[model samples]
Target: MGVDNYKLAMWTFLGSECFFFGSLIGTYMSYRGKSLTGPYPLDVFDPAVTSISTFDLLASSLFMVLAVHYAKAGEINKMLGWVAATMVGGLIFLGFQYYEFSHFVHEGLTLKSNLFGATFYVLTGFHGTHVAVGVLLLGSLAWSAKRGHLANIGETTEVIGLYWHFVDVVWIVIFTLVYLLEYT
Candidate 1:
């Protein structure tokens, strides 16, 4: 009765997400280094800048954890504050991604350019979409919190936190396999 069904549903959704992202990652790996053109991985990937974005996302995860913690403690204002912070972090991450994508397109790496371009865009683009959706969800949660309409703050925060963490984790894997591995 106490969010047991909600928790189960979230877990089921996350289980499917695992497969969804797994296939994308797998496709990216398979197509890595197959792009027979310029603006390739080395020519485009700026790890230093991307590292900053990655750190921001990781920090957002921390904020989400704190938000859930405060929600569980019934501290509505603090939870909302942390949720706002998390949304800002997500926006920053998306900004970085947008800049990167624009730069890539400017540098002549379109989705149809080659295998690398297609796979890279498809994979990271999907991830970016997920982040955008998370931002919207968090924004909605914030609005609900402000309106005093959220009945189960803890459960709500926990469910959204689960999704936020999944997005972060997927980026970690993508950063490692798609970017770091390229350098090595």
Candidate 2:
């Protein structure tokens, strides 16, 4: 058969997501270093912690790839296990984000605190939300696989993997531009 319809739709959705994230990143870049207040990137951003979180997300993408690979091979249990691993990775990334945001707030940086805070929160908050949604989707896939409810496990896994990989790539860009660039 040709490209699966769901995969086609997912690609289209990801195409749109490029523009969505592009805008957020663009805005954040334009407003970078314009905070005009305390709690700047150097002061507030914990690069070491953020790096660990980024690694967690990238590792999840790897697990997602394995899930899809096993799904294509018709190994349902292996696929489910990989999917669960991917979800755990996503959850870990979110946990780091939650801690980072909370620490920023306690240090007096918030969306309303400054231009940096506003754009930073909007960009990264949207990413965190995407990660959360991805985790939920993977969780559902694992649950359905365990219950023997998936009609086409391979296609489902591939489609979700596309989304997961997209999110991971987006985070790479964000991590580079939003976080790493601060030191340059």
Candidate 3:
């Protein structure tokens, strides 16, 4: 398929994912304070740290787009370089996620803690999983680029960038609706 068609398909999939996550987040919002006993979101969440992680994820999107640009131009090395950077960003986000999840669990806010905890953990945890998957995809693409398996680096990079952008947009919503909105 052409790049435009490929992008359309990816976006469609992402649109569906939005609904999936929306339902999860909506459920979490609905049951936010239903837990019998707990440190609530504003009380327990480290908004500062999460904000930094959000920034990191967002920056990765820039690198992703740049990689796509380079690949399209047949600048293989530059594309690979950007892909590697994107993967690093994804890894850093995942590391931050690991720390955050661990901290929450230690604070007695876990998936099984209550309704809020269950919905919150499941939704955000799934997003973290998506980040990990994106990292793997980036790594594999870089590997293929290195080994000469990617005959069209630009198009492949564009496709990956599309997926990466989808991930970033979801985080934007999560950062705003799930975290910041709670405070306001």
Candidate 4:
């Protein structure tokens, strides 16, 4: 059988996303430690709080897996439940990010404050935008499943799953490079 168009499209999109994120990360790495100001990464980063957000994002991947499994099994209600759970996880992670950004601003970090602020916000902000989009997609899937409008639930869920997993993996890299590695 030929590869499904949707699956192929999603893979192509993700390939482009890899390059997009790679450039952001590369820029961040090149600018690391060049900030000659207050609220540098070491002065403002709180890895412990970010760790919770990371865990929430990782847990959403589990929910995505369950969503796909139930969709394949033709269990609409279970699929909806899992999809909603995943969306909730994404929302919670975004909340944590919002709080962190607010705290940083209060601590004197802004996009114009220093190179660290600019690159850090740009990288993580874009990642957060991706997560928000994923949440919206999952929300739409849940709504469609509820209305019995999903024609190919299994294939659709799997496509969404690929995107969700990609976001999670990107966060793992970001968390390691931006948060964890700052200490070392």
Please write out the lDDT profile of model 3 over residues 1-184, one tens digit for every residue: 5547767778788889889888988887788778887767876799878988999998999999999998998889998899999999999999999998899899888888777688888888988989999999899999999999977777777887888888898899888877988788
Q: List the residue pairs that clash in candidate 1.
A: none
**Taking the tens digit of each residue's C-alpha lDDT, what string does model 2 give over 55-164?**
99999999999999999999998998899999999999999999999999999999998999999999999999999999999988888988889889999999999999
Q: How far is candidate 2 from the true structure (C-alpha RMSD, Å)?
A: 1.0
Backbone clashes under 3 angstroms, per model: 0, 0, 1, 0
* Model 3 segments more than 4 A misplaced: 1-5
Candidate 2 residue runs with Cα over 4 Å from true position: none
Output the worst ten-in-a-row residue range by lDDT, candidate 2.
34-43
Per-model CA lDDT versus the true structure: 0.93, 0.93, 0.87, 0.93
All candidates: TM-score: 0.97, 0.97, 0.94, 0.98
Q: Pairs clashing in candidate 4?
A: none
RMSD (CA, Å), candidate 4 to true, equals 0.9
Instruction: List where candidate 4 sits over 4 angstroms from the true fold.
Output: none
Judge candidate 3 against the unseen true structure and give its global Cα lDDT, from 0 to 1.
0.87
TM-score-superior candidate, 2 or 3: 2
Model 1 per-residue lDDT at 14: 92
Error of 4 at 100 (Å): 0.1
